[model samples]
Target: MDLGTCDDSGLETGSDAFLALRIRIETHIATIGIIGLGYVGLPLAQAIVERGYPVLGLDVDTTKVETLNRGETYIRHITAETVAAMGATGRFSATVDFDRLAECDLILICVPTPLNRYREPDLSYVEETTRAIAARLRRGQLIVLESTTYPGTTAQLMAPILEAGGLRSGSDFFLAYSPEREDPGNPQYSTAAIPKVVGGEGPEALELARLFYASIVAQAIPVSSSATAEAVKLTENIFRAVNIALVNELKVIYDAMGIDVWEVIDAAKTKPFGFMPFYPGPGLGGHCIPIDPFYLTWKAREFEINTRFIELAGEVNTRMPHWVVERLALALDQRLGRGLSRARVLLLGMAYKKNVGDLRESPSLRLMEMMEGRGAHVDYHDPYIPEVMRTREHPSLAGRRSIAWNLASIAEYDAVLIATDHDGLDYEGMVGAAKLVVDTRNVCARHGVSGANVVKA
Candidate 1:
């Protein structure tokens, strides 16, 4: 929590090279530069600053740079106070300028590797950031990519860019790949607490990278190569994506059998040894689960490996919103004998996760669209998100605004859909007011709701 600030690298990284760099790193004289000051990079800067290392932050976004310069933060989890405190020390600064790359001893790339419209790996940010660093590439500097991407990206994409500056990777400079493991809105873990997995281009590079992460985080695990490290991230996310898909598929199966998936999960979780429960929801949401698995799927094609599970998981996950809409229609028919066609539906949360405003891959948006397609009048109420912003993923949702929550307003909706289980909402009031309630996240069950009044999807 205490990110002490210190700027300026010590005696020449050129003098006795690796030995001098190692000494500076050990003595806190090494400066750390981070590119892409988004969710991952900003928090990382906080941790590095806390470790008493001077931090130079770079981002192409001018607004983020201005906000940081004004001693503020735009991300929800990272407070403005943290940025102000760091900025006050004069060592921490975020700028759009990439020319400052030559001033640091070590630079970490945490740029986004979002998928294109075709769901292929879009390494534009990574490629652009690497190319920028290469333009200012200097000897005796360590470059590590913390961006989540397809396996071999560090070696195949970024390494060549850095080496293009006529500086040999291992001998003249250092290169490594460290996958970023950041769970936004998780109060239990932070950048410094999460164990970092690092793999370098060479043994010396590995040692240097491990030492750097080890200096800030609780642990730094070294893998065989950068590809393995990249694969490690994709593997973790794919396991989550596939398992969530399995649970969602089972949710449909259990629903037909008149069994509650949540109840079944609770019962199965008691055995404790073989089962790790991933709750069925409206659909898979969040930046990582919905997207990271695809990086592997795209890469696997190069090896002639068919990732059927990944494809199937994505299919099941995508089908959930429509299925949930069908569930709503059936629930209404069973309860008030009214069809969803022309029925007023109020969706409860818009965020991908509870208490977070991030709407990336959030099923609620898809649920809204699907419900509308089914002739239901859909309006959403998310306490976390009050305004609808135009997103690259869902531009259709633009101009929509959150409705005010009240008993009278709640009663106007024929059915209420619980998409995200965010805490502190008046669900009791919602259930009492709405004629029919459809819960996708099992939030109603947790709130002691049951009987013919509520339907679990």
Candidate 2:
């Protein structure tokens, strides 16, 4: 850990630094430091630790550091046993201190790249994390960015800050970008199973990054530049956002013609080659689909080009929560002889997606706010999320806990709205208990529990 000598036992400097680092990485002796210890970084740390490399996790959040140090986890899909196993390896540790970053041979930034209030790209987290890295920049160390952002972020924004320390990138130190593709609760694709698309500032940096990732993941695809790799991540998420908007628009149009959109989609997907099925939901949720596409939208404006298709998709998706509330009101008037105003409504599933406790940018929060704005008393139930944590978008809804699941609890509401279709819910019993069921996800029909009382939005 000494920084004074030019030997392998100490820190390498001059022309031979990159070679020393390469040898350390190839031999699985380099200590990898991950900046964020949330969903992406924790799983990534586990993958590297499994490959016989020591990991040092650095985060500003003391709670996350403490939790991981104690062999516990805050994420639902990543079990406590996984965390305990990481600790058992004696190769994994988390800390809130930034000074310890210099001890690592390679540093990976996995922080959030969220949108601001205007829906523009807010790179504050990335910028701040980069400045911190620049302060402790050292030779023979490689820095890789895994957060999703617009093109040119790695070279245009990060390179200058790092070089200000008098060390040249791709020579004195190393820099690369490899967008994270972590999917929470997905059993089919673990962190190691997903292939990585990595791009570096130069050939040396790219080679180092490719070699580092190849040791852990299934495959490592090396691109020409960092911007191209950044665009790859945006393109993947934007494709989903646009297609989801298409199905959402179709759902609204088909409902007017008394057609089941899900059934139509099921039939259309049989075409095999041309058609790909994208389901209609109450709204878009999660970290990527709802926010990542807009990073490109904001960036495109800089080039004087308009992304009309992407913008329209955003509009269509955002309007879904309001349309769902309107359907609930109409269903109540026609079936129960009552209005949405002063009605007791139960919203099922508080998480963004089913079977996971991630609630970032969840449409369910917007739905609850809209329903409550219409004078409806709202409560929710999610087996994954027991209590609503404080979110920047929905601060007032904090401290609200999920209601108990039972026949008596279900019968108390005037209507039950299925916002998220988590599996293993007693759909048939719910249909029998509630006076009305407004299903946005068509879970009741999918479960073969349908009646005149159940309505699809």
Candidate 3:
């Protein structure tokens, strides 16, 4: 018989061939467990469950667990029907139990990595989750981090924590970094439709992650290392931050020149190539665009390299709230012949972006806080968010109502500041009613209300 031909008796005797078969078995049919059932994790858990895999979602928030158990979705994009269907199928559930993590063959950590008061990268949540995962670390399990953070976090910080449990990465347990790309209120891209980027510490970890993500995501792009995958997410956000800063800066320049920035952009956008439009707003907000790039800037300090562009972008963006307030003050002075002090100013729309109730890092909050500091009697009207959040920085203002689109309330305020251009708000009616309007969002131009009464920033 030829040497290449394997006899049935010889195959049974070969021990090396049996090891390969075991590896194949370990790679397939893995139960997925997603930690942190927030915007990113909950949808991912639902998507995995929809793929016919049993998924366990873990969160420390008892209220979120109760909501999930009752088939309710707190996030805007996620539907209650989807959660109910997943729950009815018995394929998805959430708990605060960390010990049960070992039951899952694949564990995805989707915890929040927020910034501290000093604008520094705060990895406390990530570290706490790592310790919890380490407690129940097991062999043959794939662990992937899906949080937006700086490069080398997965391999340098998280890998050591996982290894502390006496399991070797790439040999016993697999480790990878795959950032979450969740854009709330975007109808075009769903959780399953967005392309995922994955990288790992080694070849085995990389292959396993790619295969697993391929099963759920439409496409998976693998990079050279876990650090690159982390960098990719930062790069995407940093690009946006820089572009937004550019437009915000241009908004100030165009306003001085008595030219509408929105009109200039609309005219320039006619060119099909070399220009992708990034609009000017009151300021930048959301979890990723305003926070993620700073993580990179913080990490770059270790190498003694200054991320000047990112630093400048952050400075410009941070100054936008003050700029908007200054513009409002100017508008009030021009119209009512008085200072911002004792002037009744009303802010429209508190949520950062249009059509979403998420107010995390919203510029509107900062703008309102700055107005309050300037002695302006600030009252905001956001139909989506009834009560304004009371943080240590901004004390809760009592007796504020969502100002109905009435001509009386519009005329009462010295100047109305349009912070967020939500679709539900009546832009035309507000323009018609208000004595003076400082449109920071450029929403006034959309309604063809461009005259001396409206000021575009």
Instruction: Please give the lDDT score for candidate 3.
Output: 0.83
Residue 416 lDDT, candidate 1, scale 0-100: 90
Model 3, span 97-198: residue lDDT tens: 889997888899999898988989889899999989999987777889999999999988999998997888877777899999988777788889999999
Q: Which segments of model 2 are wrong by more than 4 Å?
A: 1-15
Residue 381, model 1: lDDT of 90
Model 1 has an lDDT value of 0.87
lDDT of 3 at 268: 90
Best by TM-score: 2
Those runs of model 3 whose alpha carbons end farther than 4 Å from true positions after fitting are 1-29, 390-408, 450-452
The stretch of ten residues in a row with the least summed lDDT in candidate 1 is 6-15
Q: For model 2, how many clashes? A: 0
Question: Which ten-residue region of model 2 has the weakest summed lDDT?
Answer: 2-11
RMSD of each: 5.1, 3.9, 4.4
- Expressed as tens digits, the lDDT of each residue in 184-209 for candidate 2 is 88899999999999999987788889
lDDT (C-alpha, whole model) for all candidates: 0.87, 0.93, 0.83
In order of lDDT, best first, we have: 2, 1, 3
Q: Which structure is stronger by TM-score: 2 or 3? A: 2
Question: What is candidate 1's lDDT per residue for 1-457, written digit by digit as tens?
Answer: 1224322332123334455567778998899999989888999999999899999999888998999999987787888899999988877988788888999999999887888999999999889888899999887899999988888998998888889868898768889999999998898998899999999998767878988999999999999999999999998999999999999999999888988889899999999699998899988887788899889888989999999879999999989988988888988887878888879988999998998878878888888888887788889998878877787877889878889888898887788989999988877877888888888888877988664678888
Which scores greater on TM-score, model 1 or model 2?
2
Candidate number of the best lDDT: 2
